[model samples]
Target: MLDWLYDIVGRILVWIHTGLTFIGFDTDSGWAWGLSIVLLTVLMRLLMVPLFVKQMNTQRKMQDIQPKIMKLRERYKHDKERLQRESMKLYQESGTNPIMGCLPLLLQMPVFFSLFSVLRSVAEGNARYGFDEELVESARAALIFEAPIAAQFNSSPEELLELGASDPIMAKVIIAIACVLMGTTTFLTMRQSIKRSISQMPDNPMMQTQKIMMYMAPLFGLFGLMMPVGVLVYWVTSNVWTMGQQHFLYRNQPVAGAAQTKNEGNGSAKGMLSRKKVAETTPEPKEQPKIERKQPKKQSRAKRTGGGSR
Candidate 1:
């Protein structure tokens, strides 16, 4: 099933690429290819924009219902199945699905892989047999940005095979930089998403998994440099787009459940605390002592004693 999905996605990518190539967008210039990728990324995201918006709204709604969910968890503490069913019930009533928020991200992976695959195949092709050999050669060279890194390495994998590892310092450095950018952007994007979601989730095994994903994705992306510079470019561009899209989504309509509620609560608490501090710091008025009829009090005892003696 997974293979079938991948094959279908790959075909879709090829169709898009073919269309772009026919339109003179994907050409020998690296700039054209880069722009095409960017446009394609934007188009794909735009096509799913409605779904993404729905996902964000659902996430916010889920967050809003978290307190109730937590109460349910406490109520069903001993019965895992009951907890699960109750949770589903809560989501159903709220019309929010936690899983839906993940769909856009999950769908992006196949598209990303397809683009990388196309770039890799083109970059790996030999130009010896075609009438338009020069164009293919130009396309291959253009696939790898003429960065100092690409200029320094054996431009061909065949060259890489023949060259000693110690000999290609410049190429290695360039590749390393590309990999680092790809990984860093990916890590940053994941970090932002997780940071946004953390307040909504309890400290539990799931949070641990989120932490792992935040770190591991970038680490995994760092390996992309070994494939080809073109692939690295695609990965890097994709990461950048992901980050940009997320930022746009968050700024426009941030997920609101735990984080926003906590923030509002904290603000209110702070206001209360401030009022208390003012009350504490404010000085109180001192009271004056009242005078009594001291003479009457003193004379009564002495006069009474004298009268009794007389």
Candidate 2:
């Protein structure tokens, strides 16, 4: 079942690639693969624009609530129950969910992995094996270059290894250059996004995580370069597209709650005092004790004895 599904998906992807190729996208050069990758990234990003908007809104709400949330923590200090209750109440009232911002990323992950698989197959010159009849014809027609990177990598593993070992210096140099571009583009894409996110954050744990990924993603990309240079070309172009899309979104919609803070001319003391007074005046009904006390009978005896003595 999985194989059948993959075949169907691969065929569909091939069709799309073929259609793209027919529409002047096929330049018959190594650049054709790169251009296809850019188109794929752009299409995926366009599809995700709605989700991105939602994510931005959620992020902004979270940012706006952060100060209040911090104040709530300080106010509830030792009261765990109160803290949980109030925090939930705040979320409910604000209609802000931190989880929403991550949903777009979750949704995009599978698509990303799928595209990687398809591109890898195509770049391996396995179009005939991976694509359907019509799509295969289209792919062949779309060949902008008679000698693509895929053709170079299409040799048997043993033959490929031999070539790599004894091939002319230029071939190795070309592959190395492709790998470098791939890694560099991936690193730059990741770095730009991380930098944007970091600039928005105020030295927090989230910022630390972003910083870690900024370094890690590039390292991962370097590993990715070990694959055929065709894959490298696809990856570099895709990363370039991603960088552009992110730049546009960041510039236009921008990330949530990342609006620059405007300084208030007046001191915030009045607002602080008002909130404090409101909390202070808010009455919390006292709880009565469970136990009851009885008066001693000795008091009555003492009263009678005193009367008799008098």
TM of each candidate vs. truth: 0.65, 0.61
Model 2: CA > 4 A from native: 1-9, 20-34, 72-89, 119-130, 133-172, 228-230, 253-310
Residue-wise lDDT of candidate 1 within 117-234, one digit each (tens)? Answer: 5544444553322213554454454433333212223355445433222334555666678878888888898898788777545543377888898889778654765556655666
TM-score of 2: 0.61
Which candidate leads the pack in TM-score? 1
Best by lDDT: 1
Clash totals in order: 1, 3
Cα deviation in Å at residue 214, candidate 1?
Answer: 1.9
C-alpha positional error of residue 303 in candidate 1 after TM-score superposition, expressed in Å: 26
Candidate 1 clashing pairs? 63-257
lDDT tens readout by residue for model 2, 243-281: 887788778865554443322323366678889999999
